[model samples]
Target: MWKIICLLSAVNTAFAGVEKNFVNFGGFVCPREEKALGRCLRDALNTYIPQLATGVAEYGVPPCEPLLIPALSVHQTAGPFAVTSSYTDVTVQGPSTMRVKDVTVDSEQQEIVSKLYIPELKMKGNYKLSGQLLMLPIEGEGHFSGKYGDIDAVVTITLGRAARPSGPDALTCEALDVKFHIGHAALQLDNLFGGDGELGNAMNKFLNENWQKLSDELQAPLEEALREFLKPLADHAFGMLRADDVLGGP
Candidate 1:
């Protein structure tokens, strides 16, 4: 019975891998003066003093900055195979605009000029995110403004796929192991908002209350965008695989 139980456990384990990751990146960069300056960026960042406070009754404009923290590069890795990939020739096409209220503000865009590579197939690649901050205010009741800005990333994913069958001389796998790539993609966040004022204190309270709104604002679009991009790519990639040889079991 024990041997049978062990065998059943192994068979019940799911077989699939679908995930990604980002490698080392700068958490902050000072606003750029000229687009021509390729390697120029600000160094000083106050991670400790800052705190993020969002939506609540104690509300007004939350004090924040309109700037971007630049990420030097974007990379992904698979945990099982330690397959690493970096994108290149990244572009955030000129004079882009993310409209907020009546104000149409202009911002800078950047790209990864050359492809960065890592040979080791560590379970995952590390990433430092360039954060964008915009404080919201009550221009009026129903009409408020989003002090909004975003950083663009131009990257290409470099990973591999293989197909397998359940039989003698069958291929080993149709996908990478989940433990290797998807599960290992890591995420981190840092935001600060404080001023020695009543409004600032309110801002802190609001953030503590409605943090989900802010997180969703940042994450939802990204999730949707990724799904849009990946769906077709996945269809194209897996569509090429031979659909015969494996018996079905649900």
Candidate 2:
């Protein structure tokens, strides 16, 4: 399991409305009305995607255009195919193009739910794996690349209050859950089985032919890794202000 710590580094610049005690970042004010809050939050997220992609240096937001993960390990022990794989120097592109189809924020429930769609996503990394895939012997250390299109994702965020010394309680991301489906995917692994061209070619062909099953087998661990990866970003963005400042009143 991956553990991520949420840290807030103070900055001189302010994005939240300090005097009004409401969310007013970049002129986008979140309405206090229950009926309108969800729409406002959705719009705000869509509007901020570009800025978030490039990152806000003053606010400590990291660039996400090509989100980088140094390393990730995934294991599938109880599936049609059991495998252990590790990926390093991973880069994922296309999140910045995500569109929110729907969103609901419930302050009382301390939860936020969103349905999102992405046109396409591209990933590249160095991978090492050892195990059986589709009952075929598999062992490799190589570079891998994948392209997925028409992705749909549902995300749920559970919020909690964090006590502050001088101010009202700030919001913290207690948990993040994500489930996603890919409409189509294409994958390739280089230098499979020590560069055995014939065997490697067959394996690659088999992988593509059975992409759906492979994706299913890997979904659980992949989603878990994604949730862990996004927690800090969520925390950093939400941790700067008190709960009321963002969702209490307009």
Candidate 3:
């Protein structure tokens, strides 16, 4: 009788995947279905994508006043002295409609691929520009806040083949690689300036007239911010899940 009981226990351990339990996501749940793991994981991700609105997102550059002017001329010296921006209330637009594009798993290679689509990253914030625009020394502040549209990124994560779970429930999984990219973006600066209303309006007009140049100047900084935003986003989505969630229990 003792030998039979030990043999039965070993058999159960060998076939654990066939009778595994569902994985939990803060509240979301995914069944441990080996054949349809990709879809299950994708569903789990969509359920947890709404946690991006709890903090301030900031971007800046040293001696930033010049970042607004298009580097069109080599002899141009007049530009803003400093520029800084901070945004808050950052939330995923269209949470109901947002979805994870796809998820792929390779047990042979111990890897997972996830695609996340964000309809928009909406936020409201303010920016200040303090510097000399001309020999006369002029500075202006603007409402540099708006919604960025159609942002998406793909994350590739690798699992350790020889790694073991630290506990009975925990799984050994880590994000080996994360890549972030942005599709479309827009900015609004209609109301900028604290003290000099007339000067602010004048600066706004100039920025509106040369908006393309301004956009060009801002591309790098904008990309930097997007990348920064993706880090937390990825952590929220991928960092919470463990190896058992994706590959079943050992």
Candidate 4:
């Protein structure tokens, strides 16, 4: 998520004068002046949020409204519980509503930093798990749902340039890092303990009650997943233009 924000900031610069080639990007380019770069980027991102949600097929970017993630696996062995869980066919909603609170670009260092907030996000999928929770045996294969709100994320992107045979050096994503906090979360896993309704309900209650701890435990993996997801998108967008064209002009 953090990566998404920073990448979008960089992509905004690439959109300068892109209207002639990509009509959807018209009117969304930020001014090249360093002084106005950050604010202009924030506004540009906000304006393009809707189009991005629906996707820009010409750019090979997928729709984000119900972002489809093939699978996610998490293994937690710290604290009082150890669990191995995998989710498939996951669909996430709410990123389209994200707002860029702030952005800073350091052209000299080729780094982009941004703060973003999402009002709420919901994820639904099928999950399979086996392990122990609170020293109790736990295992399940069923539908799962999660709702998260007030998500605040800080993202940093380190940019580099790649040699292009026919044009100026193209922009590349060298490294990306993201840190996030969720103000609240609610989770549910149906059909726990072989369809034991009591156990399933109790587990759901426990998960929601201790969501902060669980979220913390899962943060690293989640961040990694987000970074992986954004890298390709960033690369695809940046690969189309030269670094000089995007960031070196007046």
- True-structure lDDT of candidate 1: 0.24
* Model 1 ranges with Cα > 4 A deviation: 1-214, 245-250
Q: Could you give candidate 3's per-residue lDDT for residues 92-138 as a string of tens digits?
A: 23323346889887766667777767676543334444444323343
- Relative to the true structure, candidate 4 reaches a TM of 0.77
Candidate 3 lDDT at 138 equals: 38
lDDT, candidate 4, 119-198, per-residue tens: 98787889898887778788899998888888898878787889888866877878888889988888889999989999
Local distance difference test scores for all models: 0.24, 0.75, 0.50, 0.72
- Report the CA-based lDDT of candidate 3 relative to the real structure: 0.50
Report the error of model 2 at residue 44, Å.
Answer: 0.4
Q: Is candidate 1 or candidate 3 better by lDDT?
A: 3
TM per candidate comes to 0.20, 0.81, 0.48, 0.77
Q: Is candidate 2 or candidate 4 better by lDDT?
A: 2
The TM-score leader among the candidates is 2
Better of 1 and 4 by TM-score: 4
Off by over 4 Å in 2: 1-26, 217-229, 245-250
C-alpha lDDT (0 to 100) for residue 178 of candidate 3 = 44
